[model samples]
Target: WYRQAPGGSLQWVSFISTDSSVKKSEPAMEGRALVSRDNSRSESSLSLRALGPRDSARYFCA
Candidate 1:
């Protein structure tokens, strides 16, 4: 997962795998983001906590 602010380069958020392991790429996201996956459906999700104005950005998953 990644986030891109206006005019800013893409910023790494977290890494998730089918094994259900998550690696945070940014310290700011530690404890503030949650990553989960459902292998049965081949779907994944990202949850953000306590959002604020600064949190506004374009989010992407690859």
Candidate 2:
């Protein structure tokens, strides 16, 4: 897990389960987005890069 601190840096928060099936549904982001999300069903992978400032926040799985 990670959080966007007030200074705009990613800070580790906690350990997340490595189990791929544990992720929650993706949320809506106006500008920032996840790529290869469809591969999640096959347990491939999803990546997020170049996230917008507004996309900064806490993230968790399950």
**Per-residue CA lDDT of candidate 1, range 6-56, in tens?**
888999988887688645657888888888888889898899998988778
List, residue by residue over 1-62, the lDDT tens digit for candidate 2.
44564667764433323553444323443133332224456443334557676655765422
Off by over 4 Å in 2: 1-46
* Residue 29 C-alpha lDDT in model 2: 34
Model 2 pairs whose backbones collide: none
Clashing pairs counted in every model: 0, 0
Give lDDT per model, in order. Answer: 0.84, 0.44
Candidate 2's TM-score reads 0.28
For model 2, what is the C-alpha lDDT against the true structure?
A: 0.44
Query: Which candidate number maximizes lDDT?
Result: 1
Error of 1 at 7 (Å): 1.4
